[model samples]
Target: MPREITVALVQMAPELANPEANLRKMGDFVEKICTEQRTDLIVFPELSYTGTELGLKATDLAERVPGHATNYLAKRANEFNSYVVFGLVIKEKVESILYNGVVCLGPEGDVVTDYRKV
Candidate 1:
């Protein structure tokens, strides 16, 4: 038998140029989905954390590959006992650029994986 997981996609509208509010919004949205829905995984839109039009500098919100965001998301994953995938701004030391990326968190409070957008 092939094992499968259910997924819920949240199409959220985030405020541009304001990552703090957006992150809070994302947290709230995630909480709502986990509480009210039935799914094994949740997928959020691109740049879900910071929004797409922030125009932020690399260092402004760039996070280490396994930094706070991953840890935070992982905690949620543990609490909800579900996998999550959300977009974020990640730092690249070589070019000092913040690459848009999506990180996946496992239920065990571990970074399951991350894909840096080109």
Candidate 2:
């Protein structure tokens, strides 16, 4: 058996500390890619939402899994019926706990898995 998948790698410069803008841009890319062709997977750069120059702002930018960013991207995944992968800063219940993480969203908009950078 042979299988083939179409993947889109999105490379964009995120606004420093501006999650909302970054999310919107990502969604735009998703819509554009899906409309242009049938894509099986879409991948975004690490720390795509929060630019890598966080300094002490990482704490404020960190979010829990299934939080705002995931929720936002999940909608896009379901809308286009494609898998989506992206990286961001994740935080646990405790304020100081944070990890560089990657998340994969399924076609149904459910989280397939989340990986934390150790």
Predicted candidate 1 versus true structure: per-residue lDDT over 1-118, tens digit per residue: 9987788898988666567787677667767888997668888888787777666453576777788767777888778888888888888765476788999988777889999988
Show the lowest summed lDDT stretch of 10 residues, model 2: 47-56
lDDT against the true structure, each candidate: 0.79, 0.94
Question: 93, model 2: CA deviation in Å?
Answer: 1.2
For candidate 1, report its TM-score: 0.85
Show model 2 residue runs off by greater than 4 Å: none
Cα-based RMSD of candidate 2: 0.6
lDDT, candidate 1, equals: 0.79
- RMSD, each candidate, Å? 1.9, 0.6
Once superposed on the true structure, which residue ranges of model 1 sit more than 4 Å away at CA? 56-58
Error of 2 at 14 (Å): 0.8
lDDT of 1 at 43: 87
The sequence of per-residue lDDT tens digits that candidate 2 reaches over residues 16-101 is 99999999999999999999999999999999978788989999999999999999999999999999998899999998999989
